[model samples]
Target: MALPYGFVKAKIVSTPQLKSTRRPHEVQYHLHFGITVNGAPWDIAVNVGTTDADDLLKYQLVFDFRHSVLTTLKSTSPGSTDLTGTDALPALDFLRSDFLAKTGAWRNSDVMDGSDQVEPVASLQRLLLRAQQSSLDVYVFGRFYSEGDGVHDVHMNQGSRGEFIHHAGDDSNDHNDIWQDGALLVDLGEPEWALYAAAFDQQYVPTDDLGNPAPGSQPIS
Candidate 1:
């Protein structure tokens, strides 16, 4: 399950801040960016992180979710999951946890040893830099707070259970399928724009949300 909106074609407006936080019942790394949509001020948390799992250093970069929209790649990923980008994609279109690991362009030499937090941050810095100057279409699930409103779940959001299943919230206003979520589309004008999708846990939410795990109990699986 994901936000009612599909994605926001956006531009990164400033230098983003990278941060790791242990807030409430979860741990996450957030890339906070300031953005403007049609000259209207808005912020984007171009985030990729984990929850309940210590594997924060591992992430995948899907270099072709929308690449087929421009070029002729025989196959964008493994199996029948052809990321040809033939039409406007919804977040639910990508729901596999192993989508990037199996299909995206990541080198074996790029693996980060599970020792510290440098791996994801280093890679993200480069990606954010690419996004700073290049035009980007941030595919997202919308989340709104009183102080702000922005797209979240900038990662994969399927293969989930319990309250984390995005459909658990706002039934009438959400995508009802079991598998669906968010991602990013980067345009380089090279006839091959790239898309990167990530996932943490669909069960993780704000302290007040209905799906959030109960206090002092186990976090969502």
Candidate 2:
């Protein structure tokens, strides 16, 4: 039997430095998972893990739990161009149903409009909280363009690559033109969980040229 939705635990295992560019990247991490439905361990994987991080931009995190891939919660950034402009509000909605259906937890999730909202800090926090509640291990592998503002940073410019547009007589574009930079994988192992979460949060915390989380910086939440 599977564990109850909120009975799982989280911890960091390992941390690896990753380089991000306009390309797809993959990283593998080990985890120990313990699931209990009625105070009894139902499923335990000492090494259950996932691969791939190809959708990190549009989704804050791409998690593969027990071979099931889930797109992380996300909100639009400011200055982004969308078909419908100025009417979009960043709120947690698109993935609400999917998340609730998949993990049986919906405490934290959000969607933000890029044109109206400038930051997605609160959305990120909700995602973290939900991840904790569901006991659904997470692996984040992907890259997002930073817009210089800590709070309003993470953004992916898919249109810059002609993904969502098709011009008259244009035949060289594809819908899936987006590239993944890296991925995050979650392990039920306490150590692995902690490491993965730290890496992800650190990356989003904004850094200097040296890639260090800015000092005295409070990440938007």
Candidate 3:
């Protein structure tokens, strides 16, 4: 089953809030933000990796992203719109869309939940401040909640590995798909857009048509 992928173009209404998961079954880590769509409250839950040292699939966040898809994302309308089967929207595909440069793009140090450096967290804090101060619009791509109150899974959605290869007793990896990857894009001003892409080190690329990892696929890290 394909996740109900979609996009939410709205304005940031609150600062970034860090939530630490205390349970084993909850979303391990996320940077939540308050947003409004046509006067209705909505939440943007961005995965920021986990603090667990035993977890093999750590987070990888790409900052200052550059790609031609930025041009198409600029013209998107406001509010929430489902892109499950639409060709007008730029449904992201990290491996196939040429969204990521082939060289000098991946760094061994890019992480969202590190305590040593004031990097990604610092960068995201600054982004939220600017977005709030300037009232800039943010484009969030993910699966909207069934209740229609928020959006989550704002990260790469393909090429699962290890235990992620199956879900809901479905051995076919029902959650994975192409052109339905999640992302967070912000429009700063004319000719300037902020694209943030993230994925776990375990998710590989060059997925098949059904999003299963190809025989010789490479990890996104």
Q: Report the number of the highest-lDDT candidate.
A: 3
TM-score of 1: 0.59
lDDT of 3: 0.69
The alpha-carbon lDDT assigned to residue 67 of candidate 3 equals 68
**Candidate 2 Cα outliers beyond 4 Å, as residue runs:** 1-64, 68-138, 144-163, 166-175, 178-185, 190-221
Query: Model 3: how large is the Cα RMSD against the reference?
Result: 3.7
TM-score of each: 0.59, 0.20, 0.81
When summed lDDT is taken over every stretch of 10 residues in candidate 3, the lowest stretch is: 107-116
Is 1 or 3 the stronger prediction by lDDT? 3
Ranking by TM-score: 3, 1, 2
How far residue 16's Cα lies from its native spot in candidate 1, in Å, is 1.3
What order do candidates take by lDDT, descending?
3, 1, 2
lDDT (tens digit, per residue) of candidate 3 on 38-138: 88899888766555433333334444456676777676778987887443337767666666563245433233354423345556667777888899988
Off by over 4 Å in 1: 51-58, 64-88, 96-102, 105-117, 134-147, 165-180, 201-221
lDDT of 2 by residue, 1-221 (tens): 11001112222222211212222343322222223332333322211111333222223333433322222112112121112111111211111112213322212112222221221233333434455565545433222112221111112112222142424334343211122112233454433222111122112223322222345543322
Angstrom error of the Cα, residue 199, model 3: value is: 0.6
Candidate 1 overall lDDT versus native? 0.45
Whichever of 2 and 3 has more TM-score, that candidate is 3
